[model samples]
Target: MKHFLIIAHKAHTADDFSLNDLPGSAGRMDILCRCVNSALFLSHDLRRDVQIHLLLLGEPDPGRVIKFDGETVRYLNPDERSSGSLIKKALDKDSSDFEIRSTPGVTVRDANLSTLLSEFKQQGCSLYYLLEDGKEIREETLPRGDMVFILGDHNGVTEEEEAEIEKAGAIKLNIGPISLHSDHCITILHNELDRREKEY
Candidate 1:
């Protein structure tokens, strides 16, 4: 099964660049530099060909277009009439070939996590996060054998989350924060993919 892993940062989260402007965050030296970090992390312990997607969220907007780094970015442009048509149509979970386009190794500034998650699910992906809410994932959210990971925020759910995850039959693990370069992320991802990965 093709899977997409989402690394979410709320629109308000502090980073090195402006969160509202996509290119600034996507092109900034520190953010762009993370590409190597992500590559290392994802490629390290992964047993599958996993594609990581970095999703940035911010408040909804109308029809504002911003130009940066030789690319023109168009937002929802808050004033466009939807004819009552909802984004759900485009984010349908049943879509066979659906996909989400986000700036990799960078921050994505948007306001709706649910909308973003729906889009990812349409593309046959499941969300894995170390959130405090303890409900970013559900059994019915994805098929069995899917993997979800937790890092950084070990607020104490590591044990309890393991039980819930066991019940759903999803792989769960906690990797403490150890910042690495891009290639390092890839290295870590490959280790996770080793034949005896369960033993890691």
Candidate 2:
């Protein structure tokens, strides 16, 4: 399975924020919504083997993780609003750790990076940190394993967050010299990986 993890540093944790005005009180949630949309859709439909993790660190709660299961997830349409609504519903719940069964997928979790990384590690995933200055992503450079790509929101991952990710031994990868939005980066990654896999 392929996993894309995005860190939203100032994503609003409260449910009072307007979905239309994602950049205002929601703290640029539009960026995240775009990212989620990219991860879920390509040309026609969803990628069955893919998963997305959103690490929300904002208002009322700091470490909230929203996971999207493409394999068996249900009721998740091919639009940003569907994902955004589900995320909003998850945030409104009062529990720090909980799961919602939707679309044949029992998903959503509230956890920190440490716990999330640990789970991924146990699943035998090769973690890769997406950064501009890191090594360029290439077909030959890609390792053989369950891959997990970690990225940040509009402002990008903080220095401290990068440090922790680095400590976890995630190889840093740069898609290109020019900086790209997180969602664009994700689309590029999916396209590249899909092309390379079909080649082999």
Candidate 3:
């Protein structure tokens, strides 16, 4: 399975934001929504082997993780607005340390980057930290088992977060030398993976 963990540094943690202003009132949630779409959507269907996790750290509350499992997900569309709606619903539900299902194939829980990374490590997931200055992705061998790709929203991953990821033994990788949006990066990564799969 393929997993994506996006750190939405300022994404709203509550369902109080206006959908009309996802980029503003919702704390740049539009970016996260787009990332979700890019991670799981294909031409006529979803990628069943993919899962995307959004780490919301905005006002009212923070440290909430929203996970979308493409294998059993329903009602998910390619549009950003629809994705945002699903995310808002997840945020509205009460979640604890344990994951709470807000919708089919969608779960919410209270978790931070460190805890989530530890969990992934325990699951034997090969973690990759997407960075601009890291080694080229094409030069590295991709893992056949479960893999997790860590990325950040508009603000990008902070220095402290980068240090934590490195300490967790995540290999740093770069899609290219040019910087790109988080959602765009996911699309590019998916394309690369798909090409490799075809070759295999």
Candidate 4:
């Protein structure tokens, strides 16, 4: 399975924003929402092989992880309303590794990059950090095994966070010369993988 982790440094842990205006002109819930949409749906349908992890590093709680398992996820529509509701509910709760049977596909946990990377490493996932100046992404750069792609929000990953990722041995990768939004990056990566997979 392919994994994507997007970090929202200033995303609120509680649902206290306007759905009509998620960007809040200053907050990042908008970006997170878009990221969720990208991770969950493709061609207006669920992707059975992808797993998206939203690392919420915002107020009330940091190191909070919201996971979307496409294989078992249900009741998800190809609209922001569906995704927005799920995101709001997940953020409003205060727990570690909370699971909802009704929404079995989505899992929320109190986790950080270190813990997540460690778990993926144990599972034998090739970790790659997306950066603007990193090595270009190509078929040769991608691993034949399971892979995990990490990205940052609008503010991008901080120096401290970058250091932590480096410690975890994540190879730096760049998709293009120009920087793109988190969701756009996800789409590009998935497209590249899908195209390459079909070629082979």
Model 2 per-residue lDDT tens digits across residues 1-200? 89999999898876778767778888888788888788877566778888888888988778877778777766766566776677777676665576654335425557888888888888888999998788878733675569999999888888888888998889989888798999999999988888878877
Candidate 3 residue 32 Cα shift, in angstroms, is 0.4
Candidate 2 vs candidate 4: the TM-score winner is 2
Q: Report the error of model 1 at residue 167, Å.
A: 15
Name the top TM-score candidate. 3
lDDT of 2: 0.80
Q: 1-200, model 1: which lDDT tens digit per residue? A: 32333322322123333334423432322332242234322222322333333332222331111101102222221121220011212222221223433332112233233444455445554445433333322222333343323232112224553444344433443223553433343344445444234443
Among these predictions, the greatest lDDT belongs to: 3
Using TM-score, rank the candidates from best to worst.
3, 2, 4, 1
Model 2 bad stretches (over 4 Å): 102-106
Candidate 4 lDDT, 116-153, residue by residue in tens: 88999999999999998888788345766889999999
TM-score of 1: 0.34
The candidates, ranked best first by lDDT, are 3, 2, 4, 1
Least accurate stretch of 10 residues (summed lDDT) in model 2? 100-109
Error of 2 at 21 (Å): 1.4
Query: What is candidate 4's TM-score against the reference?
Result: 0.91
